[model samples]
Target: MVRRLPFLLGGIALFLVNALTLSIGFGFGLSGVPAALLIAAPVVLCWYRPMAAWWLALAGLLLLTLLGPVLSDDEALQYRPWLLNAIPAHLAVVYVLALSVRLRIAIPAFVIYLAAGALTPIHLLDDLPNAIAGAIVWAMAVLVAMVLGHNKRVRLTSTLRIAEERGRRLVLEERNRIARELHDMVAHHMSVIAVQTATARYRLPGGVSEEASREFQAINATARESLREMRHLLGVLRDPADPAETEPPPQGLADLPRLMESARRAGTPVRLAVVDTPDPLSPAAALTAYRIVQEALSNVVRHATGAATRVEVAPDETCSALIVEVHNAPPDAPPPAVERPHPGHGLVGMRERVAVHGGDMTAAPTPEGGFIVRATLPLASSTGAGEPSPDVMDGGDGRDTSDDQRIDRR
Candidate 1:
């Protein structure tokens, strides 16, 4: 009903004007032409160009004003003043025409109705009813113009909002693409760097200075750690079932032995406990578990340097799930201040991996001291081995057997 209101009002106004002219014995075209122009202003402003429509309305108003005097009765010419009303009507028409274009009003063409109202008193001469009707018509015309201006502003706002949303989506997609490429390229280089460092550290002669050996060892450790971190980040970028694009190596619970051995080499105490030993895990689940443990140990090394840490891995026979946890004492005073949140990336990557598999992970500052990371991974089968278990130290607890200080339970 609201949609058809403008058309209904316009049709009634035209009918009234036509009936008045017909009853008064005026020419049909003379009254009907101006009434039609007033009716059309509302509809034309809705779709037509503001400037063009306003200019056309101005031209029509000028022609109508001139035609009005030439064709109308020289009604009791002494008492009647036609030009006073005609001039203001003409000026009002011109003012509104330009204002419609500048303000982007919807009723660009109909504004001439206001001019017609102003001129009505000139012809009616002290007729109270017609004067009151003319005033009402002018008020309605201004009201319509205000509505149109508001509507135009709303439409522009909606269009701008849609454009902004599209731009933001495009930016997010580009960032994901760049992150994938960087992960693959950087991981490959870091792996190679690690291998070369290990070779140099082993083959270097006794004549080599202690400073040189220490530098080589530091580079080797740093490169290997960087490679692991890159692979974890790459895992976050991998889409589901994208075979053409292979994921970074699968790291899981099986990787714990190697993790402990590395920590032992760095002279850090790490205890491990493996409870229910079940068959190997699914590739995806295995990789998730591996990353959780890897990131947990990495955090301990970076934040709790020289602090004692314990790792516990248990398989719930009833639930067919694996639980792995890492806990350590807090650093001496204020935690080893990170230059940035780079170290937090490992924990974030771990959480992302676990969530994909409908698994759960928790990492936060411990109430006692230090930080703790605990993760639960679901297993498919118990009796049958799905994937080959990587070579594990298989000491009492997957920890290195050499000393009680470090252990690897596989």
Candidate 2:
């Protein structure tokens, strides 16, 4: 609306010209057409190039003031030098200029506008009274435009700053969460290494030589140091504002139904089907799978709210990788609000997670004006895991037939 405001004002200026020119009275004849375009051109241009628009506005006004009397077929307006219609167009241009540029720039442009307005009325046909009214009106328009434009710009700047800071905070939080998870895994391994190295000399059935014992001591020391550094790094990554010292339990495939149900409660029609893996996936892979599904569903809820969403998690034909696909059908009704600011991964971090396990993902819009996210996370890490049992999984509001097993809800 802000961008188009200038254009609308420009259109109003043109409409005024057209309405006046078509009336049963003297007009600028055919010359008024060019003059109207000239007057409105700046306003239309303001949205794209404010400085240039300001210049065009000034030039148009000058041309009209200098030539309006000669070109007018009407005697009363011949010596007017300026028309009231120019006021709104000028205001539109100035408002956009102040809103888009810096205060210093806007102030100088405004002063130029004021100087021209103050001087233009010097040769008015109605002399002092009309000139005084025109000057007063022009001053008020400039004042309003300057004040509102600057306020709008300031508010917009503040909003953008807040958004940027919020994004940075989210990134930091994600880093801390990942760091804690890494610390959990790496710390355990480091502890084992330290214990084994410390006991190596004595644990051997045959006692080790002094030199070998010294090397074992060195190895144990290095492992302990590394463990210490790792802990320190985790501490640094952890958010100080977070009160919890322990990590949250990681999400897995079992958590997906709950995630979908949550989406259902929020007005998104969602269905979930998970083909049970013959062999249970590793924690990391399971978590990856859960997050992939979670992110896709969240995006559907955010960007395509009220859409009928289907989620299918199964092993691929080769039975070597798990395939997760989320398809959102067209919504039956308009969304409650313009889609909210969707910071959720449509498939972003999900892609990186899948890639870590040597898998692939794809997300795109459906032909029916919906969206689909598909991913293949290799199940080779878990043997005999690819094949999915025929099971119906209930996500939200419907059920589907399956050869092996199925969970359906409607």
Candidate 3:
């Protein structure tokens, strides 16, 4: 009700102003009460029905002009040009028509208004200038209203387009982030499993059972198949603008030693340790472990360079899972100057990686004014033959690898 108050007040004001002009015709006794009512009907009806109001106003003006000589008394001839009084009401109606209707209706109504001015016979010789001036004013008002309405529509369309583009950009950014996390957490592990199984099978100790050797071969074959499928999946996820040939392989636990050496050369001292275990980690678990340590050390290098950092990788003694922790001491000096702001998607990516493996992770400030990140990834179960399940092979698909096809020919 409160929101509607302004419209109500505006409609009442329009009716009263049109009523005032109609009252002049009544005072001159040019037409009786009935004709006066007809002239005022459109003004009152315009609030409820604009199109009908336009027709009604035009008809009433024409009716009054045709009947003018008959309705006026001899004394009223002194004010013979009674149609002049209706000029304001007619202009108001034209303005409303242009504002509320489409161009087809509005343009015709304007044309009719000019036609009425020229055809109405009630105009005296002295009233010609006033009639011409009134028509000019009405045309200007209608044109201004149409121009404003067009501009408002264009602005509204432009604003909606901008909002839609912003939404599309946000969706693309989210897809790219998911692709990055998959590359870091899944591809890395698959690469490691393929490399390790191939090397371990040939390096087996003497007198190993033939069945054991077969199982190792099967595991090696499955890992390699999974790696090929992973590459295809990555290709699908990668942006089309990125060249596949230029893309590098994912890094894993095997890359830790080189990463540590590079950090040391960059002036950040670090220590690395891995606990021995008889059973190796699943590809997903190993990749999750590697990413956690990688992101943690990256944080240290960016925010706490020159700090002493320790990276620990080991199997959890209490459960069939791998535990990874990266702890760093406070920086000896302030961080180096940076060229751009960090978007801070690193921690989010770590959590996503851990969650994918049904693992838990935490990154928080330690009591010693340093930062520590810890993650535990539960190892997936293997088949009785010591191989990952067929579903795990090729990452839940039976897609044959081109590499395996080439190997078979060899």
Candidate 4:
């Protein structure tokens, strides 16, 4: 309704002018109502079907020209080409015509309408000064309407193009980020494969044949070559300005105690619990879980300061997946602008991370007026195996908050 307000208002204004023209009758008896509808309906309909409404407006002009208004008032008879009260109504149709068509169509349409308007006067030279002056005024009206409409069309098209380009760029950047993360995860496993193959002869209980040893050497070389290709690919995905190669590796599940401790220091009361298992998470899953919790905690601190927050990580009922959840209670007293809502950029990134690993996640406001986010990442030996079991750190700010930590219960 809000979007249609301008059109609705314009329709009513034009309708009223046509209504006044009908009330005066001006020589056509009961037939003027059809002419009035032809002039007025176009104002409302032109938004959806400009060309059709333009034809209707033209028909109304033709009707007025054929049955010229026979009025006693000399001043009123002067605007016969427009039928006096219909000028505004007809001008609106021309404006919309400019908006609806290309420059070739709009420019030629304006010329045809202006020429027709000038030629349609019942008596062209009876009042020479008024005739010349009316032509200038009418030409200006038509010219301004088309110019404004054409510029408006160009401006709207540019804005739509800009939005589309921005969306495409954001999508490409996100794909690169996901690619870098996968490369880092796969590179770790490939390095392990190379190491294991290199040591097979020494580690195996039974002595291997010379042929078996050669096969092991071949596997090691292949793994190393694959790692090199991935590294080259990672370089391509990374930005030239990024110093990420020198930065410390990103934190994973093992870093959560420290994360919770920082949230605690930020004035959010927080607790964590980790259920240990013999099976370990793929580096990608651990990092993604760690990021989800980190972002959830950050949002709690920003939007619900002093909220009691809990972070939990454990296997689901069947033990085939890891379930990580973060829940925050409502704040006691939010800071200025803290409660103001924002677009959830953090949640979107977390969802993308989970999606890349074929996981499902949900983030929504809680009935308690806080927020909760839960992610389920599938697990299997083929997906993730040799990473060490996560152990709680004495949370660097170096105080051991044993009461707040989950002692890895195997």
lDDT of 2 by residue, 119-174 (tens): 65765645678777867877887879988998999999999999788766655555
Tell me the TM-score of each prediction against the true structure. 0.35, 0.71, 0.40, 0.69
Model 2 regions lying over 4 Å from their true place: 1-6, 9-13, 16-26, 73-75, 79-82, 199-210, 243-248, 251-289, 297-325, 330-369, 373-410
lDDT of 1 at 374: 85
Q: In model 4, state the lDDT of residue 274.
A: 81
The whole-model lDDT of each prediction reads 0.54, 0.70, 0.60, 0.70
> Model 3 scores what on Cα lDDT?
0.60
Between prediction 2 and prediction 3, the one with superior lDDT is 2
Q: Which stretches of candidate 4 lie over 4 Å from their true place?
A: 1-3, 25-34, 70-84, 122-125, 243-281, 289-410
Off by over 4 Å in 1: 1-48, 62-66, 72-123, 126-128, 201-410
Ranking by lDDT: 4, 2, 3, 1
Local error of candidate 3 at residue 319 (angstroms): 4.1
- Each prediction's number of clashing residue pairs: 12, 13, 0, 0
- Where model 3 places Cα greater than 4 Å from the true spot, the runs are 1-236, 241-247, 341-344, 382-410
Q: Per-residue CA lDDT of candidate 4, range 136-228, in tens?
A: 687788789889888888887889899788656655665777688778778889999999999999999997889999999999999999999
TM-score of 4: 0.69
Deviation from native of the Cα of residue 102 in model 3, angstroms = 37
